[model samples]
Target: MDSLATTLLSTNLPPTDLQRDSVRQLILNYQKDVLDLRSQYRGRTSPLDVMARREHALQSIAAWKVVLSPVRRLPFEILGEIFVFCVVPSLRSRSTSADDPREPPILMSHVCALWRNVALNTPRLWSDLIFLFSKSLPKRGTVPILEDLIHPSTPHALRTYIDSGAFSVSDAPDILQQLIAIPEFASRVQTLHLKMGTRHLEDLLYDPPPVFLHLETLRLDICIGRRQEFVGRILKFLDSPTLRRLTIRCTYWEDAFCISLAPHFPWAQLVNLDLDVELKAAELVRILTQCVNLRQCGLFSLPDHKPRRYFEICTLPTLETLVIKGWEHTYWLFEIFRFPNLTLLDLVLGKWPTEALQVTPTFTLTHLALHCTYDDTEDGLALVLRFLAQSPMIESLQLNDIHGIGLIEGLTYAPSDNPVLLPRLEILWISIASWGDAAETVLRDGGEGLVQMIESRLHPDLRPSCAPAFAELWEFGFKCWKPKFSVSVQERLANLEEDGVLTWWE
Candidate 1:
């Protein structure tokens, strides 16, 4: 039987009729034998006997798979690259627990001896550090863990985020020494993010900031202490020629403090800046004027702080995206800048004045987003509608508010007065959160308003002209916190969604 099986296995040509009949007989006999074996096992007194046999078979298959795995054939260099991609960027700057099961570098090393060796040798895999201090600074015990996480031989630059805000300078001395103890750690930092208290920052600023020659991105969420007097300019102290992206958020106890940037700060190389701290309008424009190659800027102007001069128009030829928040007059701010190539504008304002729309620059805008606390007043809705009508170039619109009800009302109410609003608009995203007892009112009002808007823009007979309001709209998104819309309204939206004209989300 074995000889016949080997002969059949070796043969490439079709078997003769006699040989086919012999092979079929052999196969039937083999199947019968297997069935008999199964029956014998089924009659055993214990189920463990069957399970043991199954486990043995599975183990054999698993062993064979491990031996034949395609990944095992990859060269160490390629395998190391795959291992590097598995690591999260934050882990490179912070200290990770030795027993952490979720840490990719540690997890990958534990898979097998070969993988452990490759991970240990790969310098880039251990290059990112993320440290989140909850109550105290990292201690002496963490030093060895940090040393083991990075490749000693490779001078790979590190990306790090160190949050030592929970500790004061007095309590963090040991950990601070442990961090800068390694000369390579300081020199190799390419991306640095610090969320530390004022004492620590002052102490850090005392020494000219670490010479992060390779640094490209920096974010500082400095928590202000009682100290208001500055020993030196924080921005000017840090020097990184390659730095391009910077975000600074200053928090003082409970209040937000104004962050002042030094004149000689690395404005020339910066391409992106997001400042959550308050700044005087004139100071903002002056800082921006020096950022000649700036591509994106997000600023939160000081509340109720009037600008030094309103007539000066800041020219940012390279600016393409701008986000302004907490500004009273969105239009006045727009007039203060000449954005010839600006394509995207995001406004989180307390008011959207219609006067701003009339004076807004002539450049075409492709995307516009508005977030403010609005009421059910007709004026609130009218201004938004008028704003949309004046800005004929907008293709995408997003509106959100605390009540969520007024947004849809504003959108629906606008088209009744201005039938030609947003003729070129293609995408609309509306998000409404529950407003306690007014949740139902929001749903009812917002639902009716949405239905009216859709019908006016979509239904052929209801549309006023060949150029329908939002005629080019191919996407509509509605998000309601407490979704309790009428059945009729829901059905209409569902039908439109089914036709692939809109989508509804709850």
Candidate 2:
């Protein structure tokens, strides 16, 4: 029977009619022999017992096949890499729950003995520990399960996000104490984000701060109920030699009382700083003087207050990006500081300041963004044009919350004796809020002016002779909060988009 089976396997096609009949007869004979053996066994064994034995043999074969599978033979190192890829996405997702059953680390360990061993042995799979501290602890038994998975020998980084808004003021201390009790918490923490009420912050002042030897980033979001004198203590707690990035945001107080309290931080070593707290001109100047090595800085609001005394101009040679959001008095920044290496400047202002048109000529800026909170004014176009003229090297420009018609007309290229406004421009994004009294007239005129401006920069025939001096305008975006553009304008713009000359977004 074994030889017959081998012969049948070698045949690549279906058997002939005679061959089928012979095979059928052979099967019947084998069945008869099996039945005779069962009858011979009598009450000692039955057909049901024989069937159970067959099922057991099949199961055994399947088990052996799984053991010999190609994936099962993969090297331990290769399997470890695959496991890292599987768990990284879940780790980065903000919504992933701590006790989620489908979390990669938990699910991978529960698969089988081999997988559990692999997951536990892979250090990277267990490297990042994110704890969300809220009103209550996570689901019961989650802490124990995590404790079992994490080993002391594995080098890991910890990220703790504390939200004290949901907890009562009385419960704040207990919640913070529990978080501080985690094994080797301070030594393992690399990033800490805290959103706490003023009461909770005061509670922290009473305890000795734990030294974080490896902290690199810290963010503090404080909701102030009244003026607190614990800013210096909080800064002391966050002092770390390895820290390079910091963010401090204060709510309910726009005065310099909170910021002025803590002026002795390690600002010289910081590389990235973002402050939303209000600051007087002198305080802002003092902070910038110490942050000589800063690469990116953001000031959310600068009160319209000038320095009481003359201060030497501050220069940040390494600063590359500056973001300022303020009212009319923000122009003082340009007059007081010099950013020789600055490449990008973003401003969100309540009004456009004419003094900003006198921006220093030493900057090698490439990108500029302006967002005005109020309605458009007649002088806004001229102010923007003059600003662009100074930064002739600007490659991208974004103007938001303004009337588009006047600016569009000014940018529309025309053959003249003068040079172009932004000869190196490559990106233009304009957002118009609303057309005032003459909505219909403004929309029609703005639509026409927009098409003209885009074509002059993008169309090969209409491009200026100095087009090769800079990059082609490859991206153009326009948004309006009022009526849609006329159909004719849309068709023209669509044609340009279809031709792949530029990417358009509305």
lDDT, candidate 2, residue 101? Answer: 61
On residues 1-506, what C-alpha lDDT tens digit does candidate 2 reach at each position?
A: 45544544333223445655655666555556556555655655456776665455455445333433457557777887898887655333544443346776667777766677778788777665544444454433224444554462167676555555453534444444545555566777777777776677676667777778788888888866446555556777778888888888877644445355367888899898888876667888888889999998888867676688998877899997777775655777777888889887777645546665565532488777777664445455545555665786775566676654444444543333343356555555566654443344445664554544543543334333222221122123234422233465356446646853223122
- For each candidate in turn, the TM-score is 0.70, 0.68
Model 1 over residues 269-341: C-alpha lDDT tens digits? 8898878766656666677778889888877654454376655677778876777776555555666768777
Candidate 2 RMSD to the real structure: 11.3
Using TM-score, give the best candidate's number: 1
Off by more than 4 A, model 2: 1-93, 96-104, 133-153, 169-183, 253-261, 326-328, 349-352, 359-362, 374-378, 405-421, 436-449, 454-506
- Residue 235 CA error for candidate 2 (Å)? 1.7
Candidate 2 local lDDT, residue 262: 67
Candidate 2's displacement at residue 254, Å, is 11
Query: lDDT score of model 1?
Result: 0.59
- Please tell me which predicted candidate would have the highest lDDT against the true structure: 2
